[model samples]
Target: MKGVSLAPGDYIHFKSQVPLHKIPIGTKQWRYYDFGPKVVSPLICLPGIAGTADIYYKQIMSLSMKGYRVISVDIPQVWNHQEWIQSFEKFLDVINVHHIHLYGTSLGGFLAQLFAQHRPRRVKSLILSNAFLETRSFAAAMPWAPIVGWSPSFLLKRYVLTGIRDGPHEPFIADSVDFVVSQVETLSRDDLASRLTLTVDTATVEPLLLSDSFITIMDTNNYSAIPQQLKDQLSERYPGARRAYLKTGGDFPFLSRPDEVNLHLQLHLRQVGVEARPDLVQSIPKGGTGGSPSKESDKKKDPDDQPKDNGGNPESTSEESQLPPSSEIHSLDDQLLSDARICSMGHEDAIILMQSQYTVVNRILQSACELFIFSLLPIYVESSYVTSNNVWKFRQLM
Candidate 1:
């Protein structure tokens, strides 16, 4: 796909009442392509750090093929955070879409979460792949490089490339790096400075990176580095919400594993009852859980351990139900805790623990009790014994 280049002030606040034909987004009118399918939902794709709206061309096309109304924006070099929000609002207004399913990557994922947090009603569902939920890691990972260029391409592909090189989109990063390195050979210092400014201006968090942003980054990193507790936090934050883990790493999974990303998106949209193209089925990967536990969960168990329900399921064991006996829980629990790296006091401890009478209800209750111990010991409890909301909810169910 050819790139779409726009000057700094080229298309800000531009409006087109009718969907413009396959025109350039910046050359003249604000272009909007009509892939001409009765899309199940309108989608907005945002780029990551130093990414142009054009970088997602393959994604936009792939999604369009699946009957989606897709909009890929040309992010202004330096945009006011509020104005960007308004730009999204205006896009929805022009497109006459009340709600949208958003798929954001990296910085775009960060921004998408912010948008959903602030405007929950407008977001139908969100899929954030290889994105930073916080900025601390980003700051820690990439200390400031001198602003030596004007175009975003040079610095993004050169200086920032290292941070995302091992990311999900290794192929894209490789090609991008080659292109930028070649472009850098001939770029003047002033041009480099301009590109640095463009990159920084586009990627910088509005109103400065706040403590919340840092917390999100920390939590997201924790999600990978410490899977068990992070999954617990996510479950707490979005109760009854559906979530999944994609096998790829870094950011930009959409670019690296477009079909996988697309499959996840399709599944999520379906779960929410949103309209989507059925052709998405072919894009799904085999042997992957549609939305079930990944094998990472299976490896984290104590071998001799008894099953701990942890209030997850409560199916009774009986001839009619044919539910597996106590052995099943012990086996599954091991998988659930594998990535957690938190031991269940070892196999002997699990064996001793499992010797007692077992029932689905009892297993769930015991699991809740264990989680309560881990979660509420530090918090103040003036009037009640439990301080954490998650524990309280579990107690209610128990």
Candidate 2:
């Protein structure tokens, strides 16, 4: 077959614009797209079954332009979650990422949750789209799973295409479906079998115990692949998670409704303190020029009328100058230190109290330091100081 040519509006075009890179993971070579600045924490996007990292080209382009470092990968042919997690960890290490904000769709979402469960501290936030905790009615179809492995590539591609042909008729969605079908055609039988095994093998794991991480679950109300019961269960599992529902986008909301999906995504990212650049944001039309508010009251006011640094009252600036300087404001740090001093008998006592807290913090930090320390003597010395020494002795030394 000749190469498929994608239109400029197609997501595949964006995917092609970004160069792909290969990273060696043991005996296998994994293909990935790593774009955006290196300084920011990466937004690692994992695509659903039948999706390569290229499926999220829209997200990569949109988010990366907004100052985020986005990375997406082709799932290495690993059947079990443990192997997938281990290989992914090694891949992150090779790329020098200690922590990341994870975004995944469908099967990829399952993997993302597993990865987060395995390394909760390493995940900054999680975005799950059209994903479920386990296989539902799909497992019943697994009796024919062996057939998928033995079927000709053309037949497999046709089955996948036929299944998703009922999705929204948007040009981008159609393009994406074709692109995904093409990707499926290139997959080896072993790869297809492993992916199928992954789906069936997936089961309900314990709810993540992540208090510090932000979790967003995005799905379309019309999604049929994952039942409503599963979605409710997911919500019950993550009570604190934010949920965004589109009225209609079927199984692949990201492709069918990129504008809405992007809006929800940007809002979620902003809530966690990551925002797109002003220039990049302004470049995209509000609501993608598709829908508009019908009421005159819904119209946005002129930019000039918006509140400025002076709080929309120029005279307030002069009044503000009469107020006390910010430096004079009493802060929690100052109050805490004052309390520490008051609780002590003298300067020595205050110093000792502060030093004790520092020592405790230092001891806690040694765990992270152990990552780099190779020598046995250094480890023994640090361990001995932490375990054998009394608090009184440490205070006296301080």
Candidate 3:
């Protein structure tokens, strides 16, 4: 699991592609987590915007237990929904999955609808949870998406604990927020902006707006407002198809109201002769493995854990400065400032003066450190990861 490999059951695991084999897919590589029985069964669980394969961890495990083959696709950064769905379709071919049970949430749900419409034969049944038929709502909110991405890392904690409300269908909203925040923390301001722009540019609206399709769009809305003409067309296209509108407040029905959503799905699957196994659904207890870190713990600092403090004032304490060692001073002055670059102040004095103004010098150094440190350590390790033992490594040398 640590690296990419194929197990006996044909499970493909790739942490990262090697230099020779890797092909960049926008900002992120396409990954697939395959699970369940070797024979035919529910074969895919696609997720939505800002979503990663990890989001469907529980679903993959649960469905695998139920003897269903499941593959959650990691979406690449794409400018349009058509391109996004096209890439997903190619991936499906690569995986060689002939038949699929399409399950998607939010944007993923929209993509699922598109996929089924394009290749109805390949899709056995379609399941969309807490999603919209059109992305106008998301496109309208595009400007704010960058703010969410660039906001301080701690914002996730506030949003999860109180800012975001839990719905009956999506119980994992809080956990999902934490995971997304972790991803956002790693993004650069420009990277996030570009991604948002791409999302808005690539959103697919026409296909979803179609009145005739065998797809079901699920959400808290009871579907009462859908135009009767469109509803009639839908019934005519897939006579057995039905719309399920579970009343859940949160956007993530999979997390907050998985039971309710699952129940509805089970009922529909039964109608189509597919059995439901509640026991096969995975349930993660609160504060269980990979749960959100406690607020108090996040703020607390351990004595052993200290970030590299690059602001020590050795020059401020004259006692700590070595004697003028004329030979050393002459050598330093020569290297410090070449004749063409000499400022109004003499090179030797300027050298001493810069060090003397430790306050300003340290401030400048700290700012540079904050900006460049992320490049060196892309993982965004917490302060806890830094320790006093290696503090010297991060110290700004004067």
Error of 2 at 395 (Å): 99
| Residue-by-residue lDDT tens digits, candidate 1, 85-121 | 6655654543334567676665566677667766667
Q: How would the candidate models be sorted by TM-score, starting from the highest?
A: 2, 3, 1
For candidate 3, the TM-score is 0.48
Query: 247 in model 2: Cα distance from truth in Å?
Result: 2.3
**Model 2 reaches what TM-score against the true structure?**
0.63
Residue 164 lDDT, candidate 3, scale 0-100 = 29
Best by lDDT: 2
Q: What are the runs in model 1 whose C-alpha is more than 4 Å off?
A: 1-39, 136-157, 166-241, 277-398
- Writing each residue's lDDT as its tens digit, candidate 2 over 1-398 gives 11132222333334334556565669655777665544445678897778776777666655554545567888888867888889888877655566688888878888899998988878878998877776644566556654555666565555555556463455645555555666676677666666766776636556776653399988877544666777777777787889888887766666656667766777777887764333332232222111111233134342113211111111111111111112232333453343223313234544456557766877889976886565577888888887666776878899
TM-score of each: 0.45, 0.63, 0.48
Best by TM-score: 2
Count of backbone collisions in candidate 2: 0
In model 2, how large is the Cα lDDT of residue 62? 56
